[model samples]
Target: MKKKVFCVLIYLQFCFIFPKTSFPGFRAWLSPYRMALGGSGYLSFSPLTNRNNPASLKSKKTFYSGLIRYPSSIMGQGLAITLPKKERVVGLAVQHLSYGTFDGYDSESISTEKYSSSDTWINFYSSKRSTWDDLKYGFAISWFKSSLAQNQINAIVFSLGLQLYLKSIDANLGISLNNHGKVFSNSSNSSGEMPKETVISSSKKLKYLPMKIFFDGIFNSRYKLDNINFGGEAKINNDLEFVWGTSLNKISQNTRQSFWKSFFAASGIGLAYNINSIKIFYSSFFLGTGTLYNGVSFEINVI
Candidate 1:
């Protein structure tokens, strides 16, 4: 079966990716939904949500989303395809962030073209509904690769997530355990364990208002209290929405920084259009300064 083959692939990855050491500031890539919602994605409706909470793969459609950074070469793209039974989903996602190319010199102070320092992630996800309470269970395997000069570092991480929806309260809760694995290096002297983290998030739809509020709390084993983010989305109509939120994670003590920088307030607007069985969405967010992160996605409800 396809599931058996995928399981074998995951087993092979664990064998090659788990030999262990320690490093801080591991790759914390964010999806567009996370960026637009000020870093809250545990209960987002985008295809990329699988990266944040695999239990969010409850969609019964063929979904795709892609994001590109402004004035940069960074990109994140993902796709989700639902099974015929409509109770399970499988997905794949890829993200690449480049820190630009640098000059390679032989200690002669002479330019030798440019080599890029980049990080990439290739992830696979699957989720299914449990027999009780309609709850969802999800799993993900991530392949992390970092390229710096001639050295390439690779690692694999496993994640488990669960999602529950309370219709009486109009609220959804998602919990995830992430980054469980070890690192491997092609060069000598640099192999370590990845930073493990726990994420808890919830979203509540207000009864009186056309809005939904989201909250997320993350705990890192190596770096306690990593961040707390919350935001709200106000629906103006069935197709247009406004979003705003702030991140309290990386605030600075400097008083001279812009207010946006001081609190990391990220705001954005989104529009969606539905045509028969297909729906398209577009969204963009402020990333401080003049840079903006943009995202677009489409979904097809298959018959």
Candidate 2:
């Protein structure tokens, strides 16, 4: 069918057109809602969805959101505030990841003082509807800072995205370039290039069911890595929803293990509840290495 052919062409383009390079940092999950949906939120309706696709930054109301994540000693958290201005929406977000405290040792492995490591990102983004009613575009600029003991590095990152709504299919399609930036450091050993990625994503609401399906194709040019993520969100009621999803990396990462084991290891699940103007979300997913991570977030509409 025509749909099948179009899908194949897109896959081929992602596989062959992207160049290989090292992976970039700052790919951490920021929203529990999107995380539960298998990390495929480029076309989500939620304003708090991943900012990697800046085109999704539209909301009729101003709101603030916060989230926290736990994966053993590594902790992650983020905060975001969004406001609509005329036909455009603008937002600010900050995220932090802490790698816990570790004992620093010299080359001789002698005892040393305890030290901590962390990464932080401060982002400013805006999006607006195109002259064409069905199109939207957005851009983001971020400042990144990372520290391990005394050594630290700073970087500037940029993201751009476009989204289109197909009225006939009742679906949304989006494309984005993320984490393209310059790294600054006095250290000679560190690479000065950012890990850049291209993402194509789509989402659809089934006509006969109270559910929405999502798909994302993410290509990392630096590392030559490609990931496909798919998931679904089912409405339990007007105020409650259940979500489940998985990615290709989760299914095939542990080839030595049983197929089902690897499949379950990569799966993610979560729930969302709305109480008046406040919404709460929770998500749980496993890393490729089988580590489990849990996150919770809260959003409140200010006006």
Candidate 3:
């Protein structure tokens, strides 16, 4: 479909341009911005994965998510909101992506523009249940604008979910406990100095499985050290309406790299289109590094 939307618009312009000076030393987890905030495969996007598994939040009565992103040549917009909570089940999301007049001169000597950049992401989710047939366990917190500066990155996640049925077969499982507030903060560079190195990153999500066919994994570490990540994904169908997939991500041997992301292996392909109100979610059928992503998430149900 137009080359999976031009390989995720060239993967957001080759990794959303980063440089506020200090692009040296810190090869702990080769992060292409944590694999572009991950999500190229594995279950091919599950209601926007936080993994407290609500079974794709069950048919949705109201869930709004929109995006106009091209994080690389700069032009962005994002939004999200999923709700239905009294026993507590809510999701609020915000994404502003970024903007900047990109320094202008390739550096022959800039006269007016000093430099500037941006990053954003905000997410919140809640779930509570002790006795409710829907059986769920939830936790998610995100505020990551911290690539190094606009520092907002604070994360706390813990989730456990399960759903099972027999008649038509429906299964779900989710496990979490990621970034648990090991939040690192130490930024000051609007000219206040004091920040030689205070980088922080953490990860965990060994698996999230929703059956009919799909699985996901993550465990790239860094907070206290000792890391490992081995991924997985699988999907196949042709009747309930054709869809295919494959995925694999590996990083072990103390998993780490961060001079601009390393570690290999990638796979893709899982597209869905249900015409009417129009629905289109895509994939680039195996994209490892140059580009991949053309996410068109749509949902609107009023009942």
Candidate 4:
């Protein structure tokens, strides 16, 4: 236990002290649950699960989740509310990321002031579940915004998702196309194309054990077959759970020459505690050799 705790501390230190920039394009920070589970949330039932696979939004209860990421001190919070009627279900979600302050530099590399960056997403979705076939389909319209030092970029995207549940096998298959939209405004830097991507994911529950496993395949328009992730959760009891997973695609060596040569890739472990209608989760993962990513989230169920 002592050794494990020490390892966790070391990882957090690494995350806090390392370089802090997410990969370009659709490779932003993920939710704690998704990151903990090896980047597989396509089949998850969490209200925030739709961030990755919009089709996974089948919850009847409204949910609020807040997460914090290390290294860059990125903070994210989201809310998902569902309205269920006899005919169909309508869901609305909002997610936002705020990157902490940074030292600004001039064209000549002179230190200036400090600046902060942020990103936000708003999604409106509708989902329908087929009673006979146990199939669900969801579609969403999303608006996204990214803010830098003095420029703000905004775009609108449409996403479609499908999910199938096999009760007899206790398994689910999910797929989604996310961030397909028009770029209304171009930023100061580059073209105005939203980071569009597709994800294929599945989850399975063991009949004889208290474990759930998930697998995901991610494809980005700019980088095809960028990531493959696998993860699992083991319930220790009614209130405690253990989670572990890893991303198969390693971080690029270009990010940090030294860090890339030391660690394998992205891998992490998490623990969750649930009490009544609220759950708290914590996870840590390797981003590169010396860079680590630590995340924590609090989720609550309302209604």
* Every model's TM-score: 0.77, 0.85, 0.27, 0.79
Error of 3 at 220 (Å): 30
Which regions of candidate 3 deviate over 4 angstroms? Answer: 1-102, 105-110, 137-170, 173-212, 215-266, 269-285, 288-303
Against the reference, the lDDT scores of all candidates come to: 0.63, 0.72, 0.37, 0.68
lDDT tens readout by residue for model 1, 186-260: 563566557677889898999999989988887876646777878888887765667666565334222335876
Using lDDT as the measure, the top candidate is 2
Scanning candidate 2 in windows of ten residues, the lowest lDDT window is 10-19
Inter-residue clash pairs, candidate 2: 21-222, 21-223, 22-222
Rank by TM-score (best first): 2, 4, 1, 3
- The C-alpha local distance difference test score for the whole of candidate 3 amounts to 0.37
Worst 10 residues of 3 by lDDT: 24-33
The better candidate by TM-score, 3 or 4, is 4
Point to the candidate with the largest TM-score: 2
Residue-level lDDT of model 4, residues 65-184, one tens digit each, is 656465534556666676776757777777776655566789999988877666677878887887756798888887777777788777787888889888988899988887778767
lDDT of 2 by residue, 212-248 (tens): 9999899876545478889999999989989988877
Off by over 4 Å in 1: 1-30, 45-51, 70-86, 253-255, 258-303
> Which of 2 and 3 is ahead in TM-score?
2
